[model samples]
Target chain A: MDFFSQWVAFQTIVTKEIRRFTRIWVQTLLPPAITIALYFVIFGNLIGSRIGTMNGFDYIDYIVPGLIMMSVITNSYSNVVSSFFSTKFQRSVEELMVSPVPNYVIIGGFVTGGVCRGLAVGGIVTILALGFADLKLTNIFVTLSVVLLTAAMFSLAGFINAVYAKSFDDISIVPTFVLTPLTYLGGVFYSISLLPDFWYNVSLINPIVYMVNGFRYGILGVSDVSLWVTYGMLTLFIVSLYTWAWYLLSRGIGLRQ
Target chain B: MSSALKISGLKKTYGNTFEALKGIDFGVQPGDFMALLGPNGAGKSTTIGIISSLVNKSGGKVEVFGKDMDTQPYECKLDIGIVPQEFNFNQFEKVGNILKTQAGYFGIKPGLAEERAEKYLKLLGLWEKRDEMSRMLSGGMKRRLMIARALVHEPRLLILDEPTAGVDIELRRSMWDFLREINEQGTTIILTTHYLEEAEQLCRTIAIIDQGEIIENTDMKSLLKQLDKETFVLDVQGDLEKVKSIQGYRINLVDEHCIEVEVSKGQTLNQLFSDLSELNIEIISLRNKANRLEELFVSLVENKGAA
Candidate 1:
């Protein structure tokens, strides 16, 4: 297919995907906003009053970026995993597979859907965070770039998960076990600087730490890791995940017999 | 003058041991309505799956309108539309959106996609339910929706795998008419159906596959001609005691009112009717004991099993 044709196909998929999530706004959009609202109320207002400043910032403000990153990660990951797996479950993915659209277009379209949802829910959570704690721009470029990369990376992760998933139950296992734990431990609620030496070193290995700390740095002008290290981690993860996803799709793994 | 579809030694093996399609080869001329008949596990679905790129081929070549599938799969897929045996579309999507989305996948623009979606939906009697969720459609309506979705791209080669497997007789006949209409309009159709009567009524050519091999591939007339004799049941309004035998045909009394007669290729039913007339029997109604193609299909598959 020509480039223009592929673009149309890609746009069609993205539109369908956006319509899918928006059509079920209660399930896709509302729950994350409500859940993050409660987190801000309980953790930021109620709990942060007891804890003093960490990393030279108020406890509530310190946790805002982490909370936003968490929502983005989970929402982005869940959107692709659930949507793509549902497409496979219903066998509607065949509609794309049988068409003239290339594999990259398919991947690009779904990833865009995931990114959109992630950013959307992220925006909602950020607005909610403002009511509990004041948030100011530390570096608008860093903030936008880190969140975008994080959402795209996790969306790709979810796509890979959906591809290998055989059953609906299989789709939930990764997010519930791997993603939830990784997000909680990735310096969402605490700074790695507060951890014991060995554990602080271990937390550095968790990829989500880079995202959370990077976003925190973007928001608060403070970070446990170097800006260069954060960018390198995000870039490396995005490139590797995108390439891996493209390879799997081209090979027709999990999607075809 | 390129064939609409051509399969050369097409092969598919599932896992390590199960060979779904074994070096099958066939061709459908442009605008030909071809029936691919087979018993269960005979690789009919496998061939369709491979052609639609749902299943990977183990070996050999598939060419659609002279476009090599391997070298130009997008071009090949662009020319063909397939309706799988199972309902493979999203049930939650609106009926109209299903057709529109399908057209979009083929890179159709919004304006033309809307026009074609409307065209096919109306053609298949789905216009009223266009905005309704597809899952709410009845079985027959769902079948029609699939047909409409397959046509939105206006493909030259349309393949339906058992399109009317469970449809009521009336709806089945209507679907046959719709399929025939498209075939008449120059879309080559390859249909796989368990209903031999459907095949006999709609297809001009036939291919019978068994045990992953094509046992018969010929025009429908030629395949039917190979049947040495045709058995027909006659409902006669007379007592069996009045009739003893027929002259040139093998006759058996099925019941007091019905009798089965095997008429050979060179024989005439006029002779049997004359003999029945002599017996003072009045023919109420007469019909074939089985569809001609059904008999041929059973015999062909049975012979393959025996071999």
Candidate 2:
């Protein structure tokens, strides 16, 4: 197929995926909006008042970027994992597989869909956060860059998880066990600087830490790590995860017999 | 005539064992309606999968319209469409979106894709249910939806693997008519069916695969001709409790109303009728005991097994 056709294929897949999630808005879109609203109410308002200021800002303001980044990361990862795995379960992935659509196009399309949902939820959560905390952006470029790269990286990760998934249970295992723990420990509720030297050092090993901190730096100009190292790590993760996902698709692992 | 699809030494092995296709070879001429008949586990699905690029082949070559599959798989896939035996579409999707999405996968523009989707949906009797979710469709409608989806891109070659497996007789006949129209209009078709009568009525050429091998591949007429004898069940008007020995025929009393007769090649039915009439037995009607091709297929597979 020509480049134009590949583009069309990619657009079709992304559109279908978007339609799928939007069609079930109550499940895909509404739940996250409600969940993040509760987070803002409980963590940012109710408890934040007593916690006072952290990082030279109100506790709610300090956690706003982290909350938005959390939403982006979780939504992006779950979207691809669920959508791709459902396609495999229904065997509808064969529709693209049997067609002349390239593997990269397939991977690109699903990841784009994931990114869309992640950013969409992120946007929704940010709006909800405004009611509880004062939100401001220190660096628009860094904020957008970090959020986009983080979403892309997790989308790729989700694709990898879906490819290896044999059942619905398999799809949820990583998100529930690996993802939630990392995101919570990655400084979504509090900055890791408050922790002791040992725990802070251990927290540094969590990848989500860089992503949340980078995004936090973007929004409030506060970060525990160097922005350069954060950007480098995010770029490296995105490229590596994308390449790995593409490799799995090309090899037809867990897809073709 | 040029071949629409050519397979030479095609093979597939599952998990480094359990060979599914043992280097099978066959070809279909452009515009010819051919049947690939086999029993279960006879590698029919494997062949269809390989052609459609759903299954990776372990060895050999496949060419679609002279395009080498290994080097030019996308181009080759562009020329072929497949309706697999199983329901593989998203059940939650509206009937129309499935077809439209399939067209898009082939890089069709939205406008043209809508037109084509409309055309096929109407042709397959699915236009009325275009807005309904696919999961709501009955078995037959779902099958027709699959056919419409496969034809959305107007592929040059169409492959149907048991396309009418669960379809009612009326729907199956209509599907055959639709398929014939496409084949007549220059689309090469390869159909895999368990219904031997379906093959006899539709396909001009036939390939019988068994035990991962093509035991017989020839024209339908020639394959039927390979049957040395045809067994027919005759309804007799009068009952006669006697055994008659015909020199070149085998006759048996199935019951009071029916008698089975095996007529060998070069034998005349006229002589048998005359002999029965002389014995005061009136013949009401007669029909073949089994589909002609079914008999050939059974014996061929059995003989291959014995060998």
Candidate 3:
């Protein structure tokens, strides 16, 4: 198909996906806002009052960026995994496979959908955080780029997960076991500087740490890691994950017989 | 004129042991209404699956309107539409959205997609239910929705796998009319159906597959002619107390008011009517005891099994 045609196909998929999530707002959009609001109240207001400050910023302000990034990460990952796997379960994915739409367009469309949901939930969380803490952005470029890139990278990760998923249970295993642990230990609630040198080095290996700190630096101009290293790691993960996801889709793993 | 679809050496093997299709070959000419008939597990679905790109082929070549599937899949896909045996659409979507969404997947513009969706939904008698969720549609309506969705892109070739599997007789006949209309308008149609009567009434050509092989591929009339004998049932107005021994014909008293007569090739039905009249049996109605193609299909498959 030509460029115009491919674009139309891509737009169709994205629109369908968006409609799917939005149509079920109680399930997809509402929970994140309510959950993040509780986090702001309990962690930001209650626990934060007891803990004075971390990394030279108020405890609530220090955790705001991390909290927003965490929402972005989980929301983005779950959206694609659930939507794509549901498409497979319903056998609706064959609609695209049998059509003339190219493989990259399929992957690109779903990833864009994932990114949309991720940023949407992230935006909601950011607005909720404002009610509890005085949030300010030190760099709009860094803040927006980090959030966008992180959502995209995790969306690709979720796409790969959906491609190999045989059942609904398989889609959630990674996020619950691997993703939850990584986000918690990724210095979301505290800085790695608070850890001992050995554990601090170990924390560097978790990819979510760079994303959290990158956003933290963007919001408060304070980062435990260098911006250069954070940007480099995010770029590497995005490119690698995207290429691998594209390969899996082209191979038709867990899709075609 | 170019063929609408051509398959050569097509093969499919499931896992390591089951061979669904064993290097079969067939061609569907433009404007030809053909039936690909087979019993259960005879590779009819496998062939349809491979052509629609739902199943990966183990070996062979498939070309749609002279475009090779391997190299020009997009071009080929653009020319063919498939209505699978089962419902594979999103039940949550509105009836109209399903067709429009399907057209969009083929890269059709929203305006044209809407137009095509409207045209087909109306043609399929689904215009009033356009905004209703697909899950609410009845069985026959759902089947019609699938047909409308397949035609939204206006493909050159339309393939339907048992499109009327469970439809009522009246709806099935209407669907047959719609299919014939499309074929008349230059769309090549390939249908797979378990109903031999449906095939006999609609398809001009027929292909029968059995045990992963094409046992018969010929015109419908030629295949029907292969049946050496045809049994027909006659309902009589009065009760017959005993069987009549007709010297030249084989006849059986099915009941008091019905009789079955076996007619051999080259036998004249007028002769049997004359013989029955002489026997004082008044015929109320006459009909084939079984579909002609059905007899041929069963015998062909049985012979292939014996071989």
**Highest-scoring model, DockQ:** 2
Regarding TM-score, does 1 or 3 come out ahead?
Answer: 1
In model 2, which regions exceed 4 Å deviation?
B243-247
Q: Which ten residues in a row have the lowest lDDT in candidate 3 chain B?
A: B238-247
Query: Can you list the residue pairs that collide in candidate 1?
Result: none
- Model 3's alpha-carbon lDDT is 0.92
Return the TM-score for each candidate structure: 0.98, 0.99, 0.98
Model 3 chain A lDDT-worst window of ten: A248-257
Give one digit per residue, the lDDT tens place, for model 1 in B22-59.
Answer: 89999999999999989998999889988998888999
Candidate 1 vs candidate 2: which has greater lDDT?
Answer: 2
Query: What are the per-model numbers of colliding residue pairs?
Result: 0, 0, 0
Q: How well is each residue in B1-307 modelled by candidate 2, as lDDT tens digits? A: 5589999999999999899999999999998899999889999999999899889899999999999999998999899998999999999999999999999999998899999999999999999999999999999999999999999999999999999998899999999999999999989999999999999999999998998999889999888888999999999976456436445679988888899999999888999998888778999999999999888889998888899
Interface RMSD of each: 0.8, 0.7, 0.7
Clashing pairs in 2: none
